[model samples]
Structures are given as C-alpha cells and as structure tokens.
Target: MVPQEAYRPDAGAMTTAIHVRGLTKRYGDVQAVGGLDLEIQKGEVFAILGPNGAGKSTTVEILEGYRKRDSGEVRVLGIDPQKPTREWRAKLGIVLQTANDAAELTVRETIRHFAAYYPMARDPEEVIAKVGLTEKADVRIRKLSGGQRRRVDVALGVIGNPELLFLDEPTTGFDPEARRQFWDLIKGLAAEGTTIVLTTHYLDEAEALAKRVAVIARGRIVAAGDPATLGGRATAKAKVTWADGLVETDTPTRTVLELSRRYDGEVPGLAITRPTLEDIYLTLIEAPE
Candidate 1:
C-alpha cells in the first residue's frame, strides 16, 4: 500500500475552503497529530488516505468541531472550527465510518428528522432519490440491509444542504456495484459545487473521486499532491517494452518512433506502463514512519 501524504496548496494569507497550520492532538503519552498542515480549495474533492489509527479520524473530527485539538489553527469555510456556531455547524455534513444502529423509523422519517435540524434542508425525498434510496424511502431502517442502510446514511448527510461534506470510510462494507453507484452520487454532489473531504483506506476510491489527495502516516502528512503526479508519479518514467527490448523513458513518443523505424513498422508488442496508485500507496505506507 502507498504510505500517506497530504495536500500543500500554497503558503500565504488567502482564504481557502479548509486551512490548517501546526495542528496537533495528543492523548497521554501518545500523539495523534504532530504539527500537521493542510489546505483545501472550495468546490474541491479532497481525500485523506491512511491506514487504521493513522490520525485520519482525529484530524477530520477536529475539522468538524467534534474533537478538540491540543493546538493549531483551523478554518473551515473561513470560520474557526474550534469556535463553531450553529450556522457553521449546519453548513457541514458528516457521514461517519459507522452509522448509528437503526431504529423502527422508516428511511424517510430519519432523513426528515435530521433535515429539520438545519435552517435550509434539501427536500427529504429528493435527497433519498439522490442516494438511490427512493424505492426504499418508506422501508423501516431496521429492515434495510447493510448497503441500504449506508445509502440512508448518505441521504441524511446530504439532506441538510451542507456546503461541505465529510465522508469517513463511507463505503466500508459496500459490494462493488453498490460502491460504484455511491461514487456516482458523490460525483453529482461535487458537480453541484459541494466540497467533499473523504478519508478512505481504498486507494482506488481515493484516486477515482478526489481531485487531490493527502496520505498520512505516524500522525503527519507523508505525501500530498495530484494522485497521478504524487510522489513523482506524473514525472515518473514509463517502461517502454516490446518483444525484443525494454526501456524506461519519459519521452515514449520519441522512443516509439525510433523503435518503429528500426522494426520496419509498428514496434511489436509495444507497451508503455507506469506505476499504478496501488503500487505507490504500498510503497508510501510501508516506508519508515
């Protein structure tokens, strides 16, 4: 797995969707956060990738104003998260790693209840439809399967018409098909300008949805950038191979032309390959902390 890295937008006085500096959190002798810094732009889909107990949750919770940080400066929507107001809280939505156990209330009922907490809530039924729970809107939450229940959680999270959404391992237990469907829903939300912050162990999920990604390890950002270019992958040489020879080069087009001339036509079995997200992720995570 690729070890963790984080986003480094720029350093200066400018407002961003999320801004953090020197963030730290500790529990007794254990430090959960160690002088971390981050920056996320508005309308951006950002992912925070890490393994279990890598301080991903702690960082996110502090951003949501649910956990107190020992020290740092945090601004979400240009307002300090540590001093959150009711309006500020309403603008943020969260889908936790684990949803609360469902009760007898139907999906529609649960969503409506949560919606009422915000001043400007999206239509409950509309949100339900968006999450692909329209057919099960009236089904009791207790009767839904795990994937269905997760859809309901998503429905409730977006029902508040939040400006920013936090998804912490949102698709944890989903099957492949369900995961794809959920990805579409998230894409739709981002298309409409909802800033999303996701934390997931699934490298594929992060690469697919996030515009930028940060990998965390040992309570600090180990890597951060465009997933395609992070850790020098964008500039990383591709292996140009054929039946007869293998070479690594950045200028594959030029190499291919030469090979074609020498081969008297197309280079047989010509292929250019670069490191995949999974390969980079494993190397990063397995590195010394």
Candidate 2:
C-alpha cells in the first residue's frame, strides 16, 4: 500500500531521487562516514568507487535504512530512510553480495516466491529471462554456476518492479559474457526509469555503466563527475609513446605532429594515450591520507 504522505514524488523535497547532505556516521573512535553529500537524479545510474573501508558500506547502509546516521540529512524517494515506512521500502530494491541460500528450490520457484512479496512485482518469468536465467529457470539453485546464481540474485532484486535499485557488486561472480549481459540488463532497467545506485570495485564496469560517479576516499568524496573526465583525466597530460621511449606532455597533438614529421609517416610503434578510469582510480585510491 502506498502511503500518501511518503510515496508522493512531488512532495516538494526538491525532486531528487536520492539526496544527502553532510551525512556522518561514527563507530566509537573510527569515523565510518564523515560529511558525505550525494545527489542522484531520477533514472540516473550512479556508481560509488572506493578502496576497502572507504565508507561506501556505511554511507550506503545509512541511505538504505539499514543503519542509522549520526548526523545530517538523507532522503530516498522523497522519504527519510532514517524513518522508513513500508511504502518507502516497497519502492526500493537491494541486490547485495549475498543471495538466499535456498539451494533446493529451482530458479523459477525462487523468483516466483520472491515476487509474491511485492504488490507490484514484475512477471516472474520475465524477470528470470531479463537476468539471463531462462535456460536455468528450472534448475535447482545449488546446481547453477556461480555466475548463474549471481544472475538469480539480480532477478530477485528486480522482481519487485522497484523504482530504485541498489546494486552492491552485482556482477561479482559473472564471467565476461555474463557481465556484459548483466550490464545490458542494467541499461535496460535504467532506460525504463529505474534509478540505480551501484557500488563496485571494477573500474571498467563503473566506466561502462555509470552516467556519473563519486570516488570516496578516507570517508569522503574525493572526486566526482563523468567517468571519462573524472579527476581531470580529459585534460590531464597525455603520453606519446614509440619504440624508443615515451614522453608526457600537455600538448600531445603537437608532440605527435613533431614525431610524425620526424618519422615522416607512422612513428614506429607510436601511440598517444590519456589516463584511463582505472589509472585515475589508482591515483585516487593511493592519494596521501
């Protein structure tokens, strides 16, 4: 049942899917989250990147209503998760690293069972097919491969027909093909107006799936923006490389032109490159505390 006061999208909370300001959470002497701020729009695929213990878990848990925040404002779907209501919870889906251990049940049985809990669930068969589990729909959960099980987790996550989805390393056990398939599924979900909040260690996955990303370091956001240009990667020095050596320069075009004139055509083994998301990620994670 949708709560009139809580479930209205136009409740005048500034119209953001998820919003946070100065969020802080502490555990004794260790501050798990310190002054974090985030804003995710409707239908946006937002990714969070951080090293281990970088407050992603704490921050996200607070937002999900699984943990209490020590201070600051937090809102999800125009409702304060801190004081979550059934209607607010019904609008959200969470796909964690762990899944149900109902090994004896078949995939169809599991999905159908989970779907029963939501008032507005998607068709169980359609959910299974969307997660690439159609071939294994009748297979026992225990009989499935790790990747296939992960797909099941995804299926269960979205079966509710949620307005927002939290994906914590959703493709952990996926093979290359499975991972690509999952990405497509996520893209499809986003295209249909699902706001996805994703947390993953895989930089390429973040770059591929996220429209915007926030890099958390030392319990705070260090850098956030378009994945291609995060941390000034787009304007960062480019390296021109050849068989002999490599040189870093601001004007890679000019350097390439000089090298081209020097070689009179293709500079042997020549390549011009800028920092990749992974490169910038490494730097962001390794920055001095």
Candidate 3:
C-alpha cells in the first residue's frame, strides 16, 4: 500500500485538486474501501478502473458528498466533500449512471431549471449546444431517445460551469457515433481546465481520455500511472507476428532482426505489437493476491 503522505500534497499553483488519505468506507461488515489514498492534480483527466463491487462507486460517492465514510481524510478542491458548502457544491459537477427523469420538461427547460441552483451557472442555451443537443433542445424529456436523454444529463451536469466534473460511465448506453461525440465533448471540457475524474469499465475509454489512470481490485489500488505504461505495459515484451506463427518476447527488435535473417530480409506478414490496455486490465483483475 502507498503511504498516506505520498498522496497528500496538492498539485499546481493552487495545490491539489483532490487529496485523499486512508479513505475507508464500510457497509455493515463489508468494507467498500480499505485505506485508499489518492491525489489528483488540477486540469487532469484521471480515470479509475475497477471490477464490479470493488468499491469504485463507494469511493466516488464519498467524494461527491453523497455518502459518509467510516474514517478518512478527504479534501476535494480544498474542502471536505462530506461537509459540502454551497460554494463547494457549485465547483463540482456529477453525471451519475442514472439521472432523475424530468418527464414533462423539454431538454432546454430542464437545463435551465438545474442552472438556477448554481450561482455561476453557464448559459442554458450554451450548455445545450455544448452537449450537442441543440437540435433536440425543444424535445420533451419523455420523447427523446436514450442517447439524447443522456446528452441532456450531461448538459445538466455542466450547467454550473464546475471546476471539476465526475463522470460515472457517462457513455454506457451510447452508440458508437454518440460515444465518439461524447468523448470530444469531454476533451473540450478538459482543455478548458475542468478537472475530470472518470470511472468506466471500458478500457478503451480510459486509454483515450485519461492523462493518468488507477486500477483498483479488492478495494485496493494495484496500479496507478499513465495508461500507456501502467503495470509495466509499455516496457513489457512485444508480440512478433508473421504469416505462419507468432512469438512473445521481451526483445521484439532482436526477434524481428532474427526473423529477417531467416526470411532473407523481409518476413512475410510481419508485425510487432505490445499489450493493449484491455489486455493489461484483464490480467490485473484476474491476478491473485
């Protein structure tokens, strides 16, 4: 386990965007989080990847001030989330897996209503346009498709112009095109300096958006680093593939050079590949204590 001090310091000129130490949560006898420690910098797109019932949701809920922890130190944007003030609440945005249904309201109407809660809310029209729902802005919530409804949910989340955003499987029900569009939206928000904390089962999503990622299992962080190199993935052995066979070895360059010698210069259908995030993720989840 990482020491509590390691995850303590704030990042950037403003210090840390989020600092957590010894974060533990329990539901009856089941420990949801066990001495978790984490530090996220400002303007970073950090991802949390974990298997089902691994405490991902529990941790996020605590950070969001939706649940209380058994014992821990948590500072989100320099304030304890468990004791959120109105100002602190305004700085944070959350897109949960499921949003409440505003059945009788139009997409635009719903956004406008939610915006009223925040002191520094963004323009309702702008929020709608940003989430790519301008075309459906007039449609009632009960009449829009699932994907469109999800967009409305996102619109509400960012309506406050929050400094940090929490996205929990934001694209779970999206189709391919919708997912791609949503990714772009997230990128735009991050580019504008919104610190984002994402939790998703999609390894591809984490690889595409997260500047850094943490993998959790059994309520503990097993690995945390840049997605490309987590679990020594970038430095790990490469798989050299040819028309007839494949070989996995640490020295892929040497293997390719040797294959060239046998093939008299050019090996047929030759390609070298390294383990993908998905591959590493599955292995990490399946490994035993």
lDDT of each candidate versus the true structure? 0.88, 0.90, 0.90
List residue ranges in candidate 3 displaced over 4 A. Answer: 1-13
Ranking by lDDT: 3, 2, 1
The candidate, 1 or 3, that scores higher on TM-score is 3
Off by over 4 Å in 2: 1-14
The local distance difference test score of model 2 is 0.90
TM-score for predicted model 1 compared with the true structure? 0.87
Of the candidates shown, which would achieve the greatest TM-score relative to the real structure?
Answer: 3
Model 2 per-residue lDDT tens digits across residues 1-289: 8778785547555558998999998899999889999989888999999998999988888888999999998889988998999888878998887865999999999999999889899999899888878889999999998888888888888999999999998888677888898899999999998999999999999999999999998889999999989999999999989999899999988998998999899889988889999899999988997
Question: How far is 40's C-alpha from truth in model 3 (Å)?
Answer: 0.5
In candidate 3, what are the lDDT values of residues 210-288, reduced to their tens digit?
A: 9899998877788999999999999988999999989999898899889999999989999999999988988998899
Evaluated against the true structure, the overall lDDT of model 3 is 0.90
Q: Using lDDT, give the best candidate's number.
A: 3
Ranking by TM-score: 3, 2, 1
